[model samples]
Target: MGGAARVRRGAMRFGVERRDRPASERRAERGGTGRSPARRRCVGRPIAKARGMTHSPLRVAVPLGGTDRGRSGLGTWVQAVLPRLARRLRARGGELLAIGTPRDLDAYAAVLGEARPETLPAALDRAGASAGWHLAALGRLARRRGADAVLLPAANRRLSLGGPPTLAVVHDLAELHVRGKYHALRTPYVEHVVPRALRRAAAVVAVSGATRDDLVRHAGLAATAVRVVPNGVDVERFRPGRAPAALRAELRQALGFRGPFVYYPARLELPGKNHLRLLEAFARAARAGALPHHLVLTGSDWGAWARIDARARELGVRERLAWLGRVDAAWVPALVQEADAIAMPGLFEGFGLPALEGLACGTPVACSDTGALPEVVGELGVRFDPRSPEDMARALATALTHPVVRRRAAEEGPAWAARRSWCRTAARLDALLEEIAVAPGKAVAA
Candidate 1:
């Protein structure tokens, strides 16, 4: 556990202040409590009695425009969550509004039948515009709709131009940690804009405690201002016992891999995701006859593909590696089901979704145990040093060779994933919304 221990120690001394919580309780989580009901409906809808209604229910505005596929993990997150949030707001007779281009509006409308989506101004459709311009468009939209609060679900690149209660959900600060992972345009955004946006926000939602700490360390945010609401897994969609034999065969054929294969479903990039080290480890294991399976990587190359491909060839394991770029998201659970094991060696992660999904599907999981990976995987996966190819090779070998560890992963993984439902995650965000919307004076215990 040297690597895991080192990671824990490094995080503790990462120069971020750690507040002492009273041992009596952990008031740690997302959203605020006691959101009292309003006397009226939403702003647009009129009151009767000659209008019997009084004050209107709070309106929450969410922006939803972006391409899915390989473009944005933010897209994936918003697609999964906003619909659920819409349902919750509707149940309370509150309004949930969406602002985006037609593509964005349609995407949300498809899921949220009752969702009120408006196409944004044409200026927002142009690329390379300033974040301030985008925020201005949203502010005008918010004012028109009489929104009480605005949630920037994918607020990594931009901050509010100032309007109603504005909150941003920060997934990770990977740029602060790994400078080379992002492109030039994005480098400035992460370094300058994201921090400013977060600081100016009414409150920021950090997806993990590690991320909350990053907010404090990198962006100089108050620990009290950043709420820790973890990302979640859809257990029913990713659970064990859903892998039918015929569907498994079909998926394997489509992915063009046969026999036993270890899966690493991360985008191909530089040293950030540690794909180079993973290929090195896999090659060494294959050469030593320690590994009997091929390695299937299932994401498009963000950058460094030529280098990664060349390295695989040099390692003499090119044929043993399959570069299945960006398969349909729907195929992920089935792919996890068919894989012999799941190996992740990312240098950092705010939360490791694929690892958790693989575990949910009862697959043996191996990861670098750095950043949020240890907390996300818990005991359901094996941990190794991402910096050491030898350590990673041994961990992968163990996951494939050891019977007891493999058995525990299959038998105990569901329970681990079951505890991390999207509902619970959404509830935390909902609470944070309440706090930001109504109880602006209070600190979020979560």
Candidate 2:
């Protein structure tokens, strides 16, 4: 029995000896060093040296699969920044990976084309299923793709518990500030899940200083953890201009009766958007014969459409209110250009994008004094108390009747907006990503 055991052990030793040949011997048999340059350098090498060679072209995975169809504020950010961001990344031997459902890919096709886009399975298109995929499969996908980090542009709504070190963009804590901004069921997720996720991120980007402050104050995040990168407008696209005659004629016909109109392009939402108060203000101004311009409302109905319509009718300004519904995004700059004034009366805003767009279009802007509107609109905005119909009415009346206000906006608004260009936003974001990538114990090891 001992001799048989010795024989078995001898055979095992011989086999192991053959498999574990010397590196030189193996290399000779393989006809020279068999590993690729990257593999050769990486094998048994210091992680820092290996990382310096193999981690070239740093990759960031961006998972996007919500039903927003790239129409929300984040969507606008993506549209404005992605193309520029992609170019900058490529310049530095990095790439952007956009993974999303077919619908999402289609929604931002042009902007997304700048990145390496991969489509998620159609089954993961629904909201619940998509969220689950993001929670479960995102990390796996990042690993398979060798992504160095994950970039969640709409991190407030989408995030993963596990992934490459993450950079989360927090647009607002609107749910915490404005009651009923979202469904009651969703409020808890925002209150609990979102804050936890934001805390877990390697970095957090707030689109406005106000949003950054909210993150620090409400989310219990350290001020150092949050970086303020304000949203930017595509000044080239949203600059002062009239629609071509054909498009102008189309808009005129769509409105039925339109001379000069006051434009307020925001999602139709309640106390959050302050649409009701703005309607009341418009009604008051119209009734008092202080305002002659029709109120042009654009955007999809969120939850307050019925109330807004009812109030407009009740105030007897229904005819004066032209509900253009959600017009094409391409039509927005022209709509602003031809308007007598732009009104953004949201009670609370993280970054009042419409106000910025209006300013970019060289249109006189009448925006709320609260939140980021004042910050975004600067001295150009005719500020008003969003909660007070009287103040709103006064601002609206001034914007419409004051030719000096209109002329000054036409001259200065474009230049002011030019400073907040998408190019600058993209540069800041690129720098942030680079910093995150090379930070010790983060993405650099990957």
Best by lDDT: 2
Instruction: Point out the worst 10-residue segment of candidate 1 by lDDT.
Output: 34-43
Residue 89's lDDT in candidate 1: 67
Give the per-residue lDDT digits (tens) of candidate 1, residues 1-446.
44334334433322223344333113322112311112111222221212233433557888764334124456667766777667666766877787776656655555657568767665655445535565566767786788878888766665666677777887787767776776667777776777766676777887767787888887777777776666767775787865678877777787676778999988887878999999998986665554569888888788768888899999988888887788766677887887888998988887788888888888988887677777677756778889999777767776776666678789977666655656556555655666567745333333
Q: Which stretches of model 2 miss by more than 4 angstroms?
A: 1-56, 440-446
In candidate 2, position 86 carries an lDDT of 77
- lDDT per residue (tens digit) for residues 285-347 in model 2: 676554567899998888788999899899988888888888887688888888888999888
The TM-scores, one per candidate, come to 0.83, 0.83
Query: In order, what lDDT does every prediction score?
Result: 0.69, 0.74
